[model samples]
Target: MNEKQFDKIKNGKGFIAALDQSGGSTPKALAAYGVQEDAYANEDEMFNLVHDMRTRIITSPAFDSKYILGAILFEQTMDREIEGMYTADYLAEKKEIVPFLKVDKGLAEEANGVQLMKPITNLDELLKRANERHIFGTKMRSVIKEPNEEGIRAIVDQQFEVGKQIIAAGLIPIIEPEVDINSSGKKECEQLLKKEILKHLDQLQDTENVMLKLTIPTEANVYKELIDHPRVVRVVALSGGYSTVIANEKLKENEGLIASFSRALSQDLNANQTDEEFNDTLEKAVQSIYEASI
Candidate 1:
């Protein structure tokens, strides 16, 4: 682990930028960026287009370490290049931003009101490559749709189980158990999630630590205990379908949770915009999230 990067994540005054949209999410992300379905003929071409999109965002002046502490990258992005350097290398060495890789293979079909992560085949190989490419950590996600204790317990158990593997491979894991905001019992879901998470956290050894990326709870500061947990490095909040403005408002209401936003962060950017316009829009988004984080 990189001590400097760890310090930055633990004490930095900025938010993480979630640019880690994968194969399943690339189309929607591109559509929002003004690229249509007809823009690419095949999956490879589609990935190329999305890579170019990510490249633009990474190279933009507004997307640096000033208001951004870290960036989460898709596996492909970590493998690709940006301005003649590998993407993760560029982010860490030149841009001074910590780089994280999204390591999950998407989610499984919902069962018991939760969607657990699909099995990650050859995870050790992926983690080795991420470390070789200068990545600082890894993020994996599972989703909760309701407050089923059995389902939530399973999700957290799966996360910590995989997290231990990541730790063995010398990377911090950001375990995300997202609660669907539109669910009928959102608050109950968060409450159950918190309980499950604390139970798992208690089992970790002194040398082991992990980050938590949670949905912004329906009740502000409900995660205060998690934020102060000795085993937790930092607690971040995902945008989770909320608009940027609303996400920011709720984020400010929570004292310590910081933002790790994807759609909300890039919603204002369109491929049709000129360089000046794109940068201006990104500046505003970064500034708002940064202010809310601090």
Candidate 2:
């Protein structure tokens, strides 16, 4: 990763807006906004709704580097033209929001007590395109339904393995090992997850350059070591299913973790608002999340 590009984001607003919902999640999001299931009955309609939402986000007068340093975008949204401007370029040049690409192929069938993200077979091509487009970074994710030792270990190993490739490809990778909030033994699992992450970081001689996006642990500030690690550039938290208000409360307590929220950031936004109402609503959401980062 280019140090200048990385510093531009890390030293500014301490949060990243996760707008990288896959095709499967987009319709549900649209439905939640009262677009109705029928309105996005097919792929094209669903994509159109997402495009409009993304455009509104970038064009909002409230959009600035102060509230959001970066945004993680799905492949379609990354390539789509935002009012004839390349979506990523418009965000970087016009709004100062660094664009990060989502490279994981969602989840694969469960194995060894966990769900793993499918490998990106076209990663080299994807990275080339990202570099060509001047995008800043990349993100990939895996889910932990339960904290089985074997499962968590496999996940940590896989993330760092891919993370190394992303770094060599000239983009930072936000490796996410999202633990389910409702899982039993969540607290114990959190500690185990932390240990495994450290184990992996130790293996990487150049980890000080790595980035992490983990679920908020049951205990506050439990990731102090990882956050303070010389190899880790930034540590961010995922809201998972929490509401924005609750997510902010948890985020405020963690010294190293900044918000990289998806649903919590967009859940309260309805499609019925006027442009002024929408921007005001967005400003409040962005500001609350940004304050927690501070």
Candidate 3:
């Protein structure tokens, strides 16, 4: 691990930018940025357009390390170049922001009330490339839709299993087991998730630290223990479909959890905006999220 990068993520005051929208989520992200579906004819064109959007955001003056600690990038974006350098290098060397790669293929079909991560057939190869490209760590996700203890346990187990692999490969893993915000048993689900996560975290060795990206708890500071765990590097909150205002409001209620927002961060931005307007919008989002995080 890059010790400087590790220290930054461990103690940074700002939030991570989730620019890792992939496959199905890309179109929705583009539409929110004012790019219509008709603008791209094929998958390649679609990826190119989204990459351009990411490039704009990454290069914006408002997207600086003073208010942004790190960024989570899609696999396609990781392989691409920006400002004549690999994207990860640009983030770490030029912008002073740590870079993490999204490593999961996506989720499996919901079973036992949860959607576990699909198998990552090429994770080793991906990790090799990530290290070569100066990536600091990786993020993978699974989802829980109910308070089924069995399902939540399975999700945490799988996350830890893969997270161990990431650790062995010399990268910190951001384990994300997201609970659906609209679940009828949302609070119960959060409780079950907390219990399961604690069980796994207790089993880790002293050297095996991992990050967590969780849904904002239904109650304030419910994850304070996770935030303070010796085996936890940092605990961040996902926007989970909430608007920026709502997400930040809930985030402030939790003293330690910071933001790793995708939709909420970009909600106010538009592809049609001038550079100055875009920067101003991004600056507001960055500053607000930074304040809530700190």
lDDT of 2 at 16: 92
Model 1 steric clash total: 0
* Backbone clash count for every predicted candidate, in the order shown: 0, 2, 0
Each prediction's TM-score against the native? 0.99, 0.96, 0.99
lDDT of each: 0.94, 0.85, 0.95
- Where is the poorest 10-residue window by lDDT in model 1? 127-136
Candidate 1, superposed: residue stretches over 4 Å from native: none
lDDT of 3: 0.95
Candidate 2 or 1, higher TM-score: 1
Q: Write the per-residue lDDT of candidate 1 for residues 26-109, one digit (tens) a residue.
A: 999999999999999999999999999999999999997989999999999999999999999899988999999999999999
lDDT of 3 by residue, 152-181 (tens): 999999999999999999999999999999
Q: Candidate 2 clashing pairs? A: 207-231, 208-231
Model 3, residue 45: what's the lDDT?
A: 99
| Position 250, candidate 2: lDDT | 89
Off by over 4 Å in 3: none
